[model samples]
Target: MIVETFNKEKRNSKTVELVCDLGITGGGTAGVCAAITAARKGTKVVLIQDRPVLGGNASSEVRLWILGATSHMGNNNRWSREGGVIDEILVENLYRNPEGNAVIFDTVLLEKVLNEENITLLLNTSVYDVTKSGDTKIESLKAFNPQNSTEYIVKAPLFCDASGDGIVAFKAGASFRMGAEPKEEFGELFAPDKSYGELLGHSMYFYSKNTDKPVKFKAPEFALKDIKQIPRYKAIGKDDKGCRFWWFEYGGRHDTIHDTEHIKYELWKVIYGVWDYIKNSGEFDDVDNMTLEWVGTIPGKRESRRFEGLYMMTQQDVINQQQFDDVIAHGGWAIDLHPADGVYSKLSACTQWHSKGVYQIPYRSFVSKDIDNLFLAGRIISATHVAFGSTRVMATTGLCAQAVGMAAALCTEKGMNPADILKNRSIETLQNELNIVGQSIPNIPINSKSNLISEAAMEVSSELEISEIPFDGDWFRLNISAAQLLPFKANQNYNFQLLVKADEATELEIQLRTSEKSKNYTPELILEKQTFSLNEGEQHINVEFLKGTPNNQYAFVSFLSNDKVSLKTSDKRYSGILSVFNGVNKAVSNNGKQVPPTDIGVDEFEFWTPHRRPDGKNIAMKIYPAIQSFGSDNIGNGYVRPWGEVNAWVADLNDKNPSLKVEWDEVKKVSEIKLFLDPDYDHPMESTLMGHPEEVVPFCMRNYKIKDLDGNMLHSVEGNYQTINVFKPEKPLNLKGFIVEAEHPSEDVPAAIFEILCQ
Candidate 1:
């Protein structure tokens, strides 16, 4: 049903009531994701948003671009996209709004919620009151819409406060803390020595569009009079939009929740002032044709009331990259902190520190310690200000919301509180459920039970192989030795292929090493060593090694420094792989050199590094084995490219009929097939400082044909830019096995199948 009032307040007064399994306050990315997840899991859900549009911040009203783990493809951390629901949103947005249009993204988010049959979406409804059955639980949420003069009473078994500011939790008497915590409180070095009780602040962003003819902009009377007053004046440009004006922030020292109106006015003045300088201050004459397209009315918020939870994440936890046993979501963004002084600060508007790798967001972080039934997602989750800087990203929060929704689904099923699910060690079950639905957890692979490759005999025609190490037509000096972590089973035998470019014939030493489990997240103890002589120019070197099945899961292929030998480098960071620099754990560059922690974070960078180049370097190598040999693992085992490599079974275009064949011991009746193909997550879906938005995801399998072994064509599917493809038969096809073949495959990229899920 579409309900809108043209006037701001004059409309019919209506009262509406809804009852559901889960009631979610706020329609930010986190709330939308939670609603979508729980609804799809067969739980009745009600998603309430104050704005007429669904997306918070990301909606047209706020105009903040959605960013998460990728951190704008920051260094080393490629393929760090917050998978699951956010991935769906990003992928769909790429297809629908490749230009990154704010208005279009609004419809996309709206459609996502409205399409969910199990989700009752109430837009333009603000939660003004909460009805509590007891001190520990909320019975219902009472919301009112002034525009339509409608009152809403939402009753539910479980409630989620994804409200960014935690209004529901606050009203419910949930124990919460606002602003910066003292370093002693959490033993966090990054925290202030004394509690400021100050937040990161709210920001307003402006977008500009180009006109063919010259256009002029007149300064609004409220615009700041002097451009020199801005701190990062040089950083502002005509193309700035959304997060580009991150420095246009204020109201941190003030009560952000209560003082939002004042903050909004201040943000407006700063935004208009910046544009005025660009258009009229004689500094940017090139922008004569550009005019204001949009300016956010609602400031995108960073920190607010953080509800106390079983675990309060701190800077120490983020800095150490702590892996929690009860991890539900993970964050890779740097611990970014904007000074409470904001635009007025003489120092940089933001300061960032990187972690070695991604850190875990525990399930305990979302479950309220005081309110038994209240779950928190988004900025309102339990975290000190320093830690909140990292977890506050929409993508990370959305994943946490996914966890909450999944946990809520289980709660609805088992008739238990959110805390009971974790305290009972049912978190494993929850994790398994999350993994089954394609949510990525750090250090966790797909559940073995759901892995079809484990049960069936699997065969791949060929692994994607290239003769020369694919390079960007550039070479690096052999100053530091490098290695990449490759997954290895105890019993499997493997060899590596290198396309070494030597200036002269030289002997290069190679070693295979394993790590001390997942602790260091780097290569340790050399297992085997060998030396190979390479000729000038590009030469192939294959170092073969066989070992008895071992206990460790990862082995590194390390190369010793050989003078005049230049190794190939790739920007891509493959999953299950870590690189070494000069024998030290150098995969991540924590040189204390600051990079603008773009929306993704300083934890990720634009360039990967083989050596500590403060400028930036590629992290992974193209020098991998030609063909990998393993036992009895199906294509699904490799389907999830958790890191960077295309997790797929490839078939050469030279082959007569390129296909991946899977067979079982007996005739297995299958009705559905789920295929997760490569959508090239490495490509940017939206515009960034580095590049424009990618209109389409290249390298995806297209026009593929799935058939039975009897030469009968079961179905033909066109890969229409979808990452996950589900094919269901009108009736269950009684078949023993099937083959997916591409008659005319993608030319440059070989036909690859990540996984084929059959049930």
Candidate 2:
């Protein structure tokens, strides 16, 4: 429904309906990502930020360093590195001010929008009123700017509340909730047994440059009668790094956005008094002139309005790691709460869930329980007090907004409300989109009753591929275009190599090309070693892995290539989650390092392209790990290598037996090694299975054949069961390790499982 005249062409002879693909109110973490995502999808999007600049807490005032469940201890998650808006910021930081100490966060977002022709950004604007008809449709959203004293109405099929206060949801008559709930509601371990108004307090981040100098601070205007009783206010001697400042919570009584002026005033006094005490105390001995680092003029709020959605995620959902039928996001950060009327404290002990591995955030939480038309983003998504605490992190919030943007786009395309997309779009599809864009949805367990159309990284991107395709910008889709290489004939060796700029030890995407024809039957590349991670802007990781090949293939034949291969979980708790479900990259980076991240190990994998295909054309497929390296290895506890195809291939070695001769197909994978003593005991077929060890593990032999149900003998050498090019394929696939049935089904010594990327 969009009619466009190029900048030079004004051929609008006819009227065109400007269908807003997405209407995002509130330019915070969620709103920014949402708008950017929709714009990238070729949708006309309108972004409204009340502030002059974008970023709510992280920018407007620049809080710096985003927090996320993706590798906080030191590991970095490439998946969490969103494309669109978030990517723009990272790339800008990389070249403009790699140190990040002196970078303008708002400029980065502004640049991205200015460059994108589809997005219309409205700054210093607010959604004053919203109207909806029937149950699940938003008719118009009226935006007013006091600066210009103007008002404009926008009509969109979808609307998102990224205000962090659930502003749009509030005006749209959506169901919403505030404060904490009693323990009986969900019976979570950290519940209060009774409801209370306590929510996480807000903060203003400050950096310290004079760690060695003496700093001082005094009390504020607030009464301190029972200050000691306040849970988290204890100022341990070393509590105030560099200089100290206070930014407790407010807004419990009224609107947060409209009354931010009070917050700033309160912070200024709190800071001045705290500094007064320090300047006047003996604590000044170690310092010369106590310098005040920065104070948060813009507050970083922790709690706000939470809308009621189809599913209100509770602590139970987090505790049991419940699999949702419509998962759209994942969060692992602990639920962090602070007192509303207490001294220097956060209520982590009460509202927080023990950090197990990350869990999925449901799609049902995005829409409202009452006003079907309204969608929410950021900290305002549907959740019990405890649930919101876990997902309130900005990284996860960015994902929430990304999902909102995508869902809004879906609504416009199908002429439905976003709430319905929560149901209509299969959980698999939602999970796939998040994963393709690098958002975790690890809860699509096959064992659960939810949709089995399980989604992994739909089309894997990043270093997993053969070539790291460079873009003019930071945003790059985890996709490849092999058709562009069309007119390419079959049976040709179009090999490609992967090389990292080593500009910085950054987790990046590498893309190759492939078609959908050769997925289930291909051998993926494997890194021969592991990596030691470091964090100093950049490091050097030098290593390489050879490409793999499929078992058999004929020229001019069509095949399916795959985008991702699923990762298994490991056993061991880096966090509270089961060790098995952790990511592979984390294990690699943390493993086998003497000093760890200093003079570390390097794990490199480079897959090569095979020469031919069934149809006469060159074949190459993109490669990406099913899970981000931060995924579970599934091996659990420690490594338990699985039994591979028996080293032995079966054939009727009658030529050596003087009896009969037959060819055996090796395509059907084998898990155990079994040698028929050859009733006659003649030279046991030449292809005797050889493996890691004869007694400790199972190995394949060259001379063995499987009997099909039809009693027909299937040989390994004849290429019968199935053929795959272990080399490069055009289209990538979602692959797990081999699932083989051992000849001897023992209970304790189950078949050994090799890593998926390995043979």
Candidate 3:
């Protein structure tokens, strides 16, 4: 039920019910990315998120310099500048904070909100409840802020839960999984048996400018008394980068939930104790200007909950670099594991080799198994302990946010669920969009038609294990759920159980049906919707949607709760849908096609009108009369076509008789003027720009008041073809190059692109 709504007309407005469009939760990495993604797609959106500041970990809060995909020439950056909004923020940060320090990021986040008019930001707020009618749709969501104690009931057809913890999804009845599976299951060399729940530890980030500076302080009584019990107590004299750091830490067993407060209490003690040790040991005799400037208020947790999504990704999928039409992202980091006690444990399973390789993360990782509206990002995405180790990096998580954001916006524009988008429409659109932003979804073929997952592909053999996957090959490129490719042996096959989860719990029944009904086996599995007493953090869980059967379609995954959550899921979600490749099915390149070209036509009339400024306001524009002969061979059409001159004119309340006559001399205030020549009329010959006179420059057109009735003038600018930026007149302008600013922006930040002084 889509209603139409627009900005009401001033005081005298008409009653119009606009359909709620898009709703987003969280203002962190994923949340902001999703909002920008949707807004870029021309969707009007309401971006609701917690925290007054954005850029969760990559922000001033944690003060971690963002690491791109891969560093070129060992610089630690992989040309990830294509993420339009994200890069825009980074560039702005560099300008405002030339040093790009972690203490300030206000300028970065604010620039995006101001640039995109389609996005409405609701910061310092959290989504409390999600309302949904059934599996197919969302009604509205309720939000709350301590300052504004009043809970806001925001209504939007499309809702994106980018909260790192998957809170909305958990509240919406999403299903999820956790811990590591047995090595025999996924056959991932790193996976271990049983669920230790010991995951990657959280980081209490801090920045120190001087390493040689030392200060005097007393050790804490508690740490000194309990120093013997602290695990891995050996002081790491140097970190990975050779800085004197401490791998010596603990918190999980104590209380990871209240980590911030606990860390502050313990860190202060450690700081004093360290000074005493160094001072007493005479390591720092005469050091100065060095101090723990600040420590993170909040510890960035690497792992917590794992949602059960449509498909569970695994290390095998990554190891093989399996090609999937539904590939949402790619990760190259090894599975990094943290000890259960928030300390560096010896029980690790990450291999450094994978860092240089490419692996595909399918689109299934976005949604929760049971939670309907919820999506997730950061280290908390859906993956087994080992797999999570690989996918839990900031780079991949950012990609995940981008994927879900596009899907959520699509759900709003097209009255359908996100899963439906994957089931019905082509996944290629999402991939292409990501590519446009310069993300590398390596599996995306060149110009393929529809990038979608295969219907149903069971391993079929108990002995079908594959080890080495091609990083840039096409023949063996395939897309299968992590469950379908797990427990890899030289030869073996593994089946999967269809499951689901959601924000709230409700009765969800599932059944496997044959494509034609003439089947010897088909039974429905009536799954009971199980609800958990979800807390305010991340809680989305993943569940299998189907048992071991075939011919499954429309597997439902949803929750039942507007304020809390509700969900429904079926085992058999889809079957038998093949993706259409551009020319040859897989990625066999259409460039091989032979061409038969003949004579092309000429004097073609291409009618097109430039849209008004994207800022939603019209510009102060003017049109000039074309002083041309009756019939000239529009010879060099490399000029801006002039309006008037034997052309039809449309005006707003000015004249009954319009003419295309120009004065003998009119100063040219406006440089370029465009006209629309529809082919529906006669296709005229080439238009011309004619002039002949010593000082009578016929090319200079007149300035005839380019204004609206209300009298507003627009600043007209011409951008350089190379760099798509409007050239500022007073400042040096160049389209050829741009500045590669620091990680953050500031008022005195130097430009990344060199300036081109226009003579």
For all predicted structures, in order, the TM-scores are 0.82, 0.54, 0.53
On a 0 to 100 scale, what is the lDDT of residue 30 in model 3? Answer: 64
lDDT of each residue in 1-759, candidate 3, tens digit only: 987678586543232222346777777666677787778778787777677677766666654444333311111011222233443444345434544445456545656765788887777777777777787356777777666555577777667766666666666676655456666776666564333344444454444335654554444575343333344444423111111122333443443433546754564454445444443544543435454455556555555567777777876775455667788666654445555554434443222223223467888777665655555555556778777876765545666777777777667666666677576545766666665443445534223221111111111001111121111211111111001111111111222222223334433322221111111101122233333344332233333332322222211122222333222211110011011111211111112121212221111111111111111011111111111111111111211111111111211112222112111132223222222111110010000111111111111111222221233432332211121122223433222211111110112111111111111
Q: Specify the highest-TM-score model's number.
A: 1
Best model number under lDDT: 1
Instruction: Sort by lDDT, best first.
Output: 1, 2, 3
Give a tens-digit lDDT track for model 1, residues 35-55: 999998899999999889977
lDDT minimum window of 10 residues, candidate 1:
606-615
Better of 2 and 3 by TM-score: 2
The TM-score obtained by model 1 is 0.82
Candidate 1 vs 2: which has more lDDT: 1
User: How many backbone collisions does model 2 have?
Assistant: 112
Q: Which stretches of model 3 miss by more than 4 angstroms?
A: 1-20, 71-84, 91-98, 135-138, 193-197, 208-249, 252-281, 344-356, 443-759
